[model samples]
Target chain A: MRAELFLQYLVSGLIYGSIYAAVAIGFNIIYNATGIINFAQGEFAMLGGMIASSLASRLPLALAMAAAVAATTLVGIGMERAFLRRIARGGVLKMIIATIGLSIAIREIALLIWGESVRTLPFFSGTEVSSVGIAGAHFSPQVFWVLGVTALVVAALTAFFKLTLIGKAMRGCSANREGASLCGIDPDLMVTLAFGLSAAIGAIAGCAVAPLTQTHYAIGTGLGIKGFTVAAFGGLGNSLAAVGAGLILGMLESFSIIVVPEAYKDVVSIVVLLAVLFAKPSGIFGSRAAGALKDY
Target chain B: MLKARNLEAGYGPLRVLKGLSLHVAPGEIVAIIGANGAGKSTLLGSLAGLVRPTSGSVTLRGEDVTGSRPERMLAAGCSLVPEGRKLFAPMTVRENLELGGYSVRRRLGRKAFEEDLAGVFELFPRLGERQGQLAGTMSGGEQQMLAIGRSLMSRPELIMLDEPSMGLAPLVIKQIFSAISALRSRGKTVLVVEQNAKAILKIASRGYVMETGSLVLEGTGQELLANRDVQRAYLGKEYSSIADEREGR
Candidate 1:
């Protein structure tokens, strides 16, 4: 492949990977806090994009984006408050099933509201498909938005987890819930906050990518599956590794086009996931028992 | 300072604590010692509000705190250094100490919180030396100290320790008991529930023995130490000899 084409594929791959990273981060948050893979995570993104697309037509763009994020955050908090909280004391297996049920409910609700058509979000920067030339390769300004948003969110979350009291409390709970509880930190409240934060992050991912992939009710399932694969590949609890694994997955999918047909992109992703599961089930950076969430 | 009245609690259809009652006055070091499956830990869990009681009440400093959840119990001036020192293993010791003051920080502000941290560091200077180390990576002795120090960070008027000497060396167990003894001087009431009756009863102002979920015996530390039945059941020949020497006979 020519350098320009190679670079173009690489840029788009980074954009896609950034979106996947945000989604996987959402997975990591809920999984770390509650020890359950939130199957409804991807739907939060889809809901955010769908909400933004519809609201943008009536309201100003920024307001629509804010509303979309706020609404999705409530949905995330609601998932924890209404369902997960009730079954939280149950086994992790039960909570996983609950999330699966929640995912279906959320997707169907979006379908009823948005109809079956794909929706578009106006680019945050401009209407024109403007490109920025880096070296010999050209990329859209939305590429920058996707990458920038992902970077900003990741940095902010890193700071929050490391520096803030509540954030540290959340980490403490994830490490040992009984220990955290003894310290007067309510693990349930931390888990609920995790749900809210994860939802907002997923929504942000959807909003960033809507201008590129377009928004649709069915968009979440595919992305959710891929995002989950990324999370598993990075080792479930680690956030930085999840993003790194996401980028690598995106690159693999993008570069495989050189050898295989473009229609078989998901085939490449599936193959990679299988290889990771077989060779290193804990993901590249995860501890051997990374997937094990202890009920403390 | 702390009281549990007719407490009944258990796990899923198998009750462990059966109508047990206990009390600790202010500035006292009290120990509850029992054999395995005697519900010693359950009694502490009931007192700390970690396990909800089927009946009866837990009160700290005159306020009923029965079944009030662990956080509320801590808020009500009671802290539990749980069994096995359930520290946040991945976090730094400093973080563990800070989290111990979670409710304290919220209610007492940073200045008081920091003072409490200083007090803990003073109590266990080793924790001060290894503030940045992971709690799990520390030695068993250090971990026990950190657990006790963490509980102290809450600045609770009453501190309850569940099996603080469970897996520690003899010297470490001695150090822990001495620390418990010092708490009485520092104006903090302590409740230590342990299987290591000999060591705990050494520092305890008063002691209770539990058997199959009920308080089988209660008396002053010396009285219990002198009780032949207590000596045969919980204390061995070595401890009995030491008690006899201390009594000058």
Candidate 2:
């Protein structure tokens, strides 16, 4: 029975952790390209969840999820083209302020569209799907979906950056923008593409976790903060590090319930975030150069 | 052929190139020698479209390409090797070369790209051997060769090199100069900006001396090498003037 309890907490923590890692990956994509923190990142995920939930009521689950992710990706590209790219050369402070404003605007739009009510999405494989047992504890198949999706996304991203010509150019820009520009790769286009891909990743996470977490106009605020914390914890610009940090964070949150009241989980998380940041300002796996939040 | 007429450009309020004009005809090696901060790199940069001239016109093969963006300039067949041999250090040498040929590869097919890659490898056999090696791990001379080799991957009509001799030893500089001469033999128009005046003059067909954001003198390599002012400022006091071999005297 004790072993079952341990497995439940551990497996559940890892599932939640993978979700956080997905969000962190979103933050990393734009950050790597432009060194912008992209405070609007969480909103992409929020939009994904809310949009998918609403669409699933009328459309098939697969199609709805696809549309939601695609719509969110377009929104991400629009954000870059309509605003971020215009102000890209205007220094980091300006970009930060602009993204904060955009985040607030997006949140308000969400509130207007979805209203204040929390909404639920139907389980992708259905709620009645049998759960696998570990000792006496049961683990849902949804957990596997989340973990599997995260692995697939990671694999896809690695190949995209390594194998594709456009992806290689994006990496070249990230490594040295001037060198990339000289090679006839436009930095602006690469940045816009980065935001689009980032949004798609965020939306995938949002859609994946919506059935588990439920969606609300206000859920983004907490998730955004947590994702940012994970990104910082991993050391900004290092996407792989972000995953490790997110997993550790999710596990820490899950295990903390053993000592603290479940209601105090948010407080525990905030405390841990502060403690980890104070101890290693660069996060656990961040290199000294990447420790600085913005390269510019 | 490339031509710059009365180019004036600079950063913010500080002007660097004040009415600087020069040209590199087809298949010629033109060297610009100047002291540090005299705007040698800026001149090359402006020509390469990395820096926009406040007022001037740049003509590449008789097409007015003034104030064009670097990517457009590169696509139009001009490439700058840039100062400091800035290789994408973490990437492999082949990756660097591929990126160098990005515009050409996009325009021409992969077959043309492969052929260009073969030519670049032929020029620098050492680079071919270390195609998979991380560029950052290479020696300074190897990096310079890779930088030049990378530029050659573009198969550019006019190739501008900035400070290729900045950090290399004598033997490496000799090898680099030989490569520059070899580039001329292959009909690539070359513009070299260097602080190593004496060495650069040896292979350059024509040369210019820049001082305080302006070209103070323009002459054939032999003439500039014999100029008293150039000798005093750049080439040491030991350089004997070629005055006795003066053409029209």
Candidate 3:
């Protein structure tokens, strides 16, 4: 491949990688708190994009994005209060299945409201024709936006978990629910917060990437699978590793165009997911002993 | 400091605690000794609000707190060091201790919370030395100390422990009992359940012998320790005496 093309692919990979990393982090947050993989995680992104795009017709872009994120967060909290919390007594498998049902329900609702038409938020900085040139490679400025938002989210989340009382309490619930409750930390409240936080992060990623990928009701399913692949590739509970795994997966898929047709690009992710599951079920960064102790 | 009346609690269809009742006065160390299946842990669970009692009343510091939930129990100044320690294995000792103070941290203020942390470290200097170490990486004895220290961080007026010597060496058990004894000096009420009847009764001001789901004997620690039935059932003195006689020792 030519140097310029390589740089373009790398930038493209980084943009998509940041979005995937955000989605994977969403999965990690909920999984760590509840011990269930929330399949509706991707729909949170779709909701953000769709809500923001609709509001963008009448409101400022930044306001629309912020409102969309806040609204999605409420939806996340509602999901927990209405479905997850009610069915929590049914065990982890039941809760996971509920998330799958929720994902479908959310997608159908999005279709009902937004229809089949594709939607996109206006670029934060410039139109589609506007591009930034970096080292002979030209890409949309939204790439920088996506990268920036992901980095900020990661940093903020790290500080929240490390420095704040609520964050440590949430970690307490994740480490041991019984122990946490005994310590006067409400497990239910932490789980609700986890859902809200995960949804907000996913929404931010969705809004940031909307101008580039365009939003459709059906985008959630694809994003959900890809995000899960990245999360599993990193390790289910480890968020930092998910970022690296997302970038690696994104780069592999982007560069696969050199060897395979565009139609086969998605095949790369599926292959990687299967290979990781079969060879190292714990994740790339997780030690074998630690992996053995965890329930995939 | 703590009172339970007609407490009936169990996992569905299996009645573990059948109308048991007990009380612990302020600044007293009360011990409950029972066999493995006597529902001793369930008793602590019900009082700490981890397990909902089917029918009962738990009064703490003159307030009715039955089935109030664990956080509420903590708010009422009651804390339970649950069986097996249940430490947040992935978190550091300081973090574990910090979380134990979660309920009262705001009320205690930052300065007071730090004092509480310092108090826990003072109680278990080993924990202080390894403040940054993960709870799971500690030895069994150290983990027990961390568990006790974590509960103490809450500044609970009433602290309940479930089997503090469940799986410890003789020396470690002695260390744990000494710490429990030390709680009395600090003016904290302790309600402890133990299978090690002999050791617990030594430090316990008062003791109860539970069987099935009811207290069969209640007396001062010295009286229970000298009771023939308690010695036969829990201390194994009768069996040891019989073996000695058979071997002509």
Candidate 4:
């Protein structure tokens, strides 16, 4: 690729990374709050794409996203209460299998309802090819929205966890469930809250990326795995690191396509994940977040 | 006052506490001494709502609290420092303390919360010094102190500690014990389960001995410490010979 093409791809990849960052951070929330990683996370994101796409065509642009987020939040809460909570508290292995089962059920249900065919993902903003000249290159408005949304979500989450009482209680559960209980904080309720919060975040990400990629029921599996990779890449519980690591993964995956065939894009991401696992085991930013996650 | 009546509790099918009964009066310290699996921790767990009692009642100031959730227990003037120093490891010492005060009772007003924080800091000045330090990074003694101090943040009428001196220096144990005494002096009721019997007995106003999930002995500190059987079996045989003579070893 020429220098200009390379720069453009790099920027586009960063934007894609922002989407991953949003989804990956969802995994981080539940992983931190409870030791269980909700494998059904991607379904919530997919719901975002579907709901937002349907509503965006009719409702005010922002309200459509809100409705989508609210719906996914309830899905997340139902998934936790109806299924995940019971088996998860038993053992780590049981929890893992339970989440996997939940994922399969979610995917099948989505397939039954939405069908297997890919559907269009509507953009949140007007799809006019708005451009900006930066130094000598132009960037798309869509890419800028992706970056802006990720930043806003990150900022909001940081504030919630740091400042609010319920947020602090959630953090208390993440760091030390028993200790939090001793302090009059209900770990179980907090775990449930974490799932809802994560679902909303995942839905927001789905809404953000829906216009770029078509929606499909089976898409949850790959997206779920990718979200897990981003969580692991940043360490299990750290939100900011998940964001940073996600963008990095996205950029690498997108840029890799220039050298290898597009068919190998998925393989490149998996390979990089393995490399990170082998190199840091904890992740690139794993140690930094490790402190927050030790109790779980 | 706090009381447990015929409390029966266990995990799955294994019953750890079998009809155990005990009571602690206001402004008093009660030490519960037992062997490792004598259901010492189990009894505390039941009291803290970490375990469900199959048949029994826990009452604080005449309120039936059996199966009351941990958060409710805290709001009702009952706080427990669990077996391990379960500090929010990633959180700063101040954050840990702040969370400790998460109770409806503590939400009375700003002045009350501030008063509680001040009281906790006064109890463990070391925690005050290391308020900004991460809990997981602190030393065993410091963490133990923080655990106690964190529990104190709730300003409960009854503070129950499970093995506060489990893994600490003799000096640290002394500090923790003295703090317990000071707490009593301030009219707080305290219940402690400990393998560190000698020190626990020394500070406790009264003591109960448990053997295999049953309450075997109950007396004032001096009475139990002075009993030859109690001294040899639990209080450690130096003060009396009945335990040694009975052993025949």
Candidate 3 to native Cα RMSD, angstroms: 2.2
Q: Write the per-residue lDDT of candidate 4 for residues B1-249, one digit (tens) a residue.
A: 898999998889988888989999998899999889999988998998888899989999999999988888888888998888888888788888778876743467556777877888888888888988988889888898888888888878899999999888999888888988888888789999999888888888999999988898999988887777777777556643564565785
Per-residue C-alpha lDDT of model 1 across residues B1-249, encoded as one tens digit per residue? 888899999999998999988899998899888899999888888888788899988888888888999888888889999998888888899998889988888887899888988898888899999999988778999999999998988888899999988888999988988888888889999988988887777788999999999998999888897777788788875665766776999
Q: Model 4: per-residue lDDT, tens digit, A82-169?
A: 8777777587777777888877887787778778778665555556466666656777666677788889999999999887667877
Better-scoring candidate (lDDT), 1 or 3: 3
Q: Which stretches of candidate 4 lie over 4 Å from their true place?
A: A112-126, A288-293, B109-111, B238-249
> In candidate 2, what are the lDDT values of residues B1-249, reduced to their tens digit?
899999999999999999978888888999999899999888989998889999989999999999999988887889999897777776789898988888888888799999999999899999999999987778999999998887887778999999999888999999999999999998898999999999999899999999999999999999998788888789766324434334433
**How many clashes does each candidate structure show, in the order listed?**
0, 0, 0, 0
User: Could you tell me which 10 consecutive residues in candidate 4 chain A have the lowest summed lDDT?
Assistant: A121-130
| Best-to-worst ranking by TM-score | 3, 1, 2, 4
lDDT of each: 0.89, 0.87, 0.91, 0.83
| Candidate 3 wrong stretches, greater than 4 Å | A289-296, B239-249
lDDT tens digits by residue: candidate 2, A203-227:
9998888877888987777788788
Interface RMSDs of the predictions, in order, are: 2.3, 3.4, 2.0, 1.4
lDDT of 1 by residue, A213-257 (tens): 898998999889889989988988789998899999899889889
CAPRI-style grade of the A/B interface in model 2:
medium
**Superior by DockQ: candidate 1 or candidate 4:** 4
Provide TM-scores for the models. Answer: 0.96, 0.94, 0.97, 0.93
- The lDDT of model 1 is 0.89
Best by lDDT: 3
